[model samples]
Target: MTDQLSQLKQLTTVVADTGDFASIAQYQPEDATTNPSLILKTIEQSQYQHLATEALQFAASTLANGTQAQRIALAADKLAVLIGHQLMQQVPGYVSTEVDARLSFNSMATIEKAHQLLDLYQQQGADTSRVLIKVAATWEGIQAARVLEQQGIRCNLTLIFSFAQARASAEASAFLISPFVGRILDWYKKQQPDADFSGAQDPGVQFVRKVYQYFKQHRYPTIVMGASFRNTEEIRQLAGCDRLTISPNLLAELADSHQPVIRQLHADVPFIEVPGALTEAEFRWQMLEDPMATDKLLEGIRQFAADQQKLEELLKAV
Candidate 1:
């Protein structure tokens, strides 16, 4: 147990990136996170199918005297909160439940959805402090997070890729930030396979390091969570980050290995300094200039939005 716990601690803070309570219990990650996509995947598994039915039943009961649209919306919120509750039961740390991805671009709608998720969790006897509302790192989403954070609801800024998103999320004083390492590697691998990321020169490694450095340099309290890992190499490169939310498969891979994990990032090292605080215009310009970040951000949102719609259709069928 010491060896396992040491390995888990030496690397980034291990966060179980699944909706399955059993897996989370087995590993005992410090935290857990779920998105619409993860919830959708979990419901397809035979073992987890009960969660969906439970959600549907709860929604049905709540909406017994309400309209169809109201019932569906309430059902979605109930499902997310119930899943969050199950995860909290397995892990002692915080559990993240995302707002509907379709509301990512609408500040008011996103805020309303976030409140609905929180309300449902409270009704289930869960503490709001242990629940982080996950939202995409869109401009509007960041704004919504700003408002949510002010209202005392911690927010986890998800789908973050580039420095701009990280900067904006930190500026908003979000509770946590999940920057995708695997997706960034996927993009760069296709475009520059010959580029060496194994060394300190890896672009993906450099990107995350930069974000971590910025947060530390600015003394921002937002936690950096490296996510969406494709391979151990990316994870290895990001060792020493504040946190890393790894998939169950990757966690298994890390657990089975005995290779040495080194500390790659530290607070003492001086980070590259950027110009003074960026205005919204400057942030937008930088994101626009980086075509890759711009394209990937929009693409990620579109994919999540589509998956969200698909999940809604499934709920309606139920």
Candidate 2:
């Protein structure tokens, strides 16, 4: 019998959700994703320090007249692309590089940063076509992604927690959307400490199931990638999703087990019709109504931004 990891791959595209090249090689996922947190975690290793050094060199040469803050920001961007470029070599499919989280609400700045990252990837001889610029699924972020998509750059809308965010992302023609699984479960667990949840009953698992059904029923082109899983059960429950981005620990767990992996989600599931494309007001209202979604989205952004700042500080010290 094949390991659960191998079995799951036959049903869904597996994606490694880390910046470490060694893990990417070992898991052999078709695609991989990285954000400020992952990148910060990876570069702390001594072997990966050269990427930081190289990023600083690139920044200094390119932004000689810019301020120290400007140089640090450029270095941060370069470092992310450098890590992504390396990851691209390990994966056969897309590698997602994120826009600065602080710019999540600035549509124009987000677009500009996306262009900058692509340009850096091009200069590094990385295949631009295989790269997906990751943007937060804020209304501004979605609008920026809409523009970038029109200009032929694909985007991965990250930190999605609501159906409204999903609908807006699809309506914007985003290439992909990552709805976090573990984080949703985290919020629910905090709310009900005494309650135990697992398998299909997991709130995070249920959330992705709904989004997958909506996308499939509506025949939206945007891909639904379940991410930030807490355990293999969350991953197992979301089997047959468009894609699943998993951390190395969970991937290792799946590889060790020969448990039967069943196809739990399918495109034929019953769907709830959301009226139409979400307006900014409607999007904001929906976010307001779902406290879990609202809390998680804000926390995700702040955590990413904090890690991004840490990455910059790391680069400055190098």
Per-candidate local distance difference test: 0.83, 0.94
Per-residue accuracy of model 2 over 1-318 as CA lDDT, tens digit each: 999999999999999999999998899999999999999999999999999999999999999999999999989999999999999889999999999999999999999999999999999999999999999999999999999999999999999988889889999999999999899999999999888787888898998998888888878889999999999999999899999999999999999999899999897755556466788999899999999999999999999999999999988899
What value does the lDDT take at residue 200 in candidate 1?
A: 62
lDDT of 1 by residue, 27-52 (tens): 78999999888888877777876766
Task: In candidate 1, list every pair of residues with a backbone clash.
Answer: 197-202
Q: What is candidate 2's TM-score against the reference?
A: 0.97
In order, what is each prediction's RMSD in angstroms?
Answer: 2.2, 1.3
Q: Residue 39 in model 1: shift from native, Å? A: 0.3
Highest lDDT: which candidate? Answer: 2
- Per-model clash counts, in order, read 1, 0
**What's the true lDDT of residue 158 in model 2?**
99
